[model samples]
Target chain A: MKIAVLSGKGGTGKTLLSVNMAVIGENTTYIDCDVEEPNGHLFLKPKEVIKEKVAVKIPVVDMGLCNGCQKCVEFCKFNALAYINNKLMVFDNICHSCGGCVLVCPEKALTEKDKIIGEVQKGVSQGINVLSGILNIGEASGIPIIDKLLGEEPKNSQKTIIDCPPGSACIVMESIKDADYCVLIAEPTVFGVHNLSMVYELVKLFNKPHSVILNKCLDGKNPAEEFCIENNIKILDKIPFDSELGTLNSNALIAARESPKYKKMFSEIFKKIIEEAQHEAAVNP
Target chain B: MKIAIPVNDKSLENGVCQSFGRAPYFLIHDIESKENTFLNNSAALSRGGAGVKAAQMIADNEVDALLTPRCGDNAAGILKVAKIKLYKTEGDSIEDNIKAFNEGKLSPLMDIHPGLHDHGGR
Candidate 1:
């Protein structure tokens, strides 16, 4: 079974929840899909990881075979190809790597070249296998890296927990597409409520079985609780804000490692997810 | 000769729009006939390539010159390829900028600005 952990906005404790659950969850394999700023590793501290560079196919123009027809320039929707000062200028940041330029080139001047955009690391953390993709800075988007990671996911019998990036973008969609269940980590703030609704809409559009895990549930009823109740969305677990856990999180340590309470909570959360997933499978089947 | 001016409104009084790509409308004034017409800058609604689309619109109109506060590199490339002389906005009012163009007071725009990622304009 595959479970994806995501949030509408960043700093909503997605990594915290995912990393803790992955460490305590039974026979779990964790994959961090947030290529832009993956921090799950900071907590997991996996050892003896194998690293591989992630590359995207960017267009390379063979000027010798070229006529200055500007056909490729006209075909690019991103305006990444430009005919400037009697030469072709490529804005790689704007390029979506669609390879339309290669096909539209009447002069046969375009060829695809691999450009390294990120790296993926495979490691083992406390008997749990972890895979992560990290995008190079100023790469415009992390969708390509995320796509590559998901496309090449290691096949295993272990229960998979995918840690997705913030926002309901193409990258986020790519992460949750194959998930059997989605765990949306949300806070109790105003922005949290707004973004949670937006992400929930996307998850619902995908028709995936999803539930909310309200992180840092404060002293009283917050906006997240009210929104979830009104929408009839299930609240899987409510992990209260703890100062000691915050300190451990700040130090890049998983709270479950030092505290028995967090360990039991993570285990319970994992068990609840499994039970719900199995129940849904049985009913849907 | 004809010129294009990015405008806040279709009228002559409104100041030139700050960015070229996402301008609301372009005021095309024909120097020979002393006649003016407004063309909606449809590129303003595009998610991407607004600069390229706007440049193509102005170029297709056969404008001799373009006046704007800023032109992104992509738009500048298209305008240059079309052989349209790009001029910097000399004043807030389109009427004044047109007068400055007639007097040869406005300098040609050369510095290329960065692309505005969104439809929001100046």
Candidate 2:
């Protein structure tokens, strides 16, 4: 079963929950799709076994093929090409690697060159395999790195958990697209509720069956519970704000609060996710 | 020599458009012919990088100078590369700015403001 953990707003503990699940779950492949900043390794402390660079194809102008039709400039949908003073300039950082520019050049002056944007790191820790993508700074797109991580032929595990980037933009959507189910982490505040609904709308748009997990909760009624009740979404679990857990959280360690309590908690949550996926599979099949 | 000015309307009697990228119309004035031809600023409707597209459009027109209140850094870089001189309006009226341009009374523009484009998603 493939599961994606995503949140609309940052600092809501998406990584925390993802790493915790990775520790407690067995035969799991943990893929951190948060290429912009993947911190899951901090918690899982996976021993690096494989490392590989990922690149995207960006257009390179030959400057010699001898025609200046400006067709390549017009064909670039991302506006990565600039023609100034009879010279072709490329701001390749923004290039989406569509290859349309090369195809449109009448004189075949434009060619594609591989540019390293990011890299995918693979490791193993505590029986769980970890794969994370690291994006180069100042780069506009991390989707290429995430794409490679997802598309790579991998050691198939019984369960796959994707740690998605924050926000409901293309990055988050692309990360969560292939998941069998999504676990949305939400806090319980006015802003949290607003962002929750926003990400919930995204999940609904993707038609992904999902459950909400409340993070850093106090004891009583909260907006997340209320919204879930009204929306008929299930509350898989809640992790109360404990000072000890906060210490562990800061150290990038998961579910060390009372060992057994948190371990049992994550195990149960992982089981619930599988059960939902199974139910959905039965219904669709 | 030619000069490009962002105008609110196609007519030379109109006022200058406050926006550079989203300007409604542009007047390309030929210094020798003393003729003014108007081109619709299609960059106004660009989904992204309107300033850069507008700069490209201006460069394509083969104008020697650009007259506007402001230009974004990205567009200004393009204009600079194309060797297009940047200038500011002496007054709001297109007629007055043209007169100022002829007398060289308009000041050169250096700094630019943020371009108007919706950040599609955060």
Candidate 3:
């Protein structure tokens, strides 16, 4: 079964939950889908076995054989082309490399070129295989890198745990789209509940079964729990606010190793996810 | 003969320079023709980073010059490659800024702020 852990806001322990869950699953493959700022390797400490450069198609304009009729500029839907003094200007960033500009160019001045935007790293940590894609620091769009990472998924694996980036943006949706089930990690604060609702809506749009995991559940009362109850969503588990867990997390230490108290907690969460996936399968069958 | 000034509405009006939440409007004006095109910055305003996307817009738009208070290093390098001139805007008003640019009154920015990443080699 493939399980994805996602949150709407950053610093909500999405990586923490993902890493711990992978550790507890034993023999699971961990796919870090957060291509922008992949922090999973810091915790997993994987031995990178292979690294591949990821490239995007950009436009390359030749000035020599050009009529510069501005047809390429007119054909570009992204506004990635311009004509100046009978010269064709190609904007590499805005060029979606759709080849529309090239096709419409009267002089055949436009051609496609490869621009390195990011890299994909495949490694192994303990018993689990790890794969992560890192977007080059200045690259704005991460969807292409995410697509490359998903394409590199190992063919044979007992269970795959996907670590999705924060928010309900296109990148996050793409990462969690094919998951058997999704684990929405949220805190009990108002902000957490609000973002959780946003992610829940995204999951609902995909028609995927999802459950909430309230990390750092507030003492005495849980606002997320109430929200979940009102919305008729099941609360998977509640991990109490633990100071030591927070400290270890900051220092890039695995929670299951640093705090023995949380090993059973993660194991319990893993078992529940498996049970839920099975239940989903049974219902569908 | 037109210069493009990429700025958020707040920076164009208040003169309060902020690192984030800049508007996505280009103040384009022809120096000789006196024609103006306030083109909306379709890419940079919507996207977060001020790197490849910004550079591409300037290059592809055939913008002769850029007028802004500051720029990240990656953006500067990309613009340099695209042969777009970078200048720092002095006045607060969009009209005054364009006038200054047309009269060759604005100063070229000497220092490029090191963005989250430096593209020195490329």
Tell me chain A's TM-score in each of the predictions.
0.95, 0.94, 0.92
Error of 3 at A167 (Å): 1.5
lDDT for each residue of candidate 1 in B56-117, tens digit (9 for 90 to 100): 78877889899888998778877888889999997698888988999999998877776664
Candidate 3's displacement at residue A88, Å, is 2.6
**B1-57 in candidate 2: lDDT tens per residue?**
999998999887778888887898899999889999999988787655667778899
- Give candidate 3's iRMS in Å, 1 decimal: 6.9
lDDT of 3 by residue, B1-122 (tens): 76777655524464413331143666666778877666555555433334445555666777778877777665676677667788887755677777677687989977777653222321
Lowest summed lDDT window (length 10), candidate 2 chain A: A251-260
Model 3 per-residue lDDT at A160: 88
In model 2, the runs with Cα more than 4 Å from the true position are A219-221, B5-39, B67-74, B87-122
Against the true two-chain complex, what DockQ does each candidate achieve? Answer: 0.25, 0.29, 0.14
Please state how well chain A of candidate 1 matches the true chain A, as a TM-score: 0.95
Candidate number of the best DockQ = 2
- The positional error of residue B4 in candidate 3, measured at the CA in angstroms, is 7.3
lDDT of predicted model 2: 0.84
lDDT of predicted model 1:
0.85
A1-285: candidate 2 lDDT, tens digit per residue: 788999888889888888888777778889999988889888888895698999899888888883777887777766677788888877665577888998888888888889998899999987889999999875668888988988862656878889999999889888988889899999988788888898999999999988999988998879887888999988988878778777878877777333887788778877887898789878975
Proportion of the native interface contacts kept in model 2: 0.32
Sorted on lDDT, best first, the list reads: 1, 2, 3
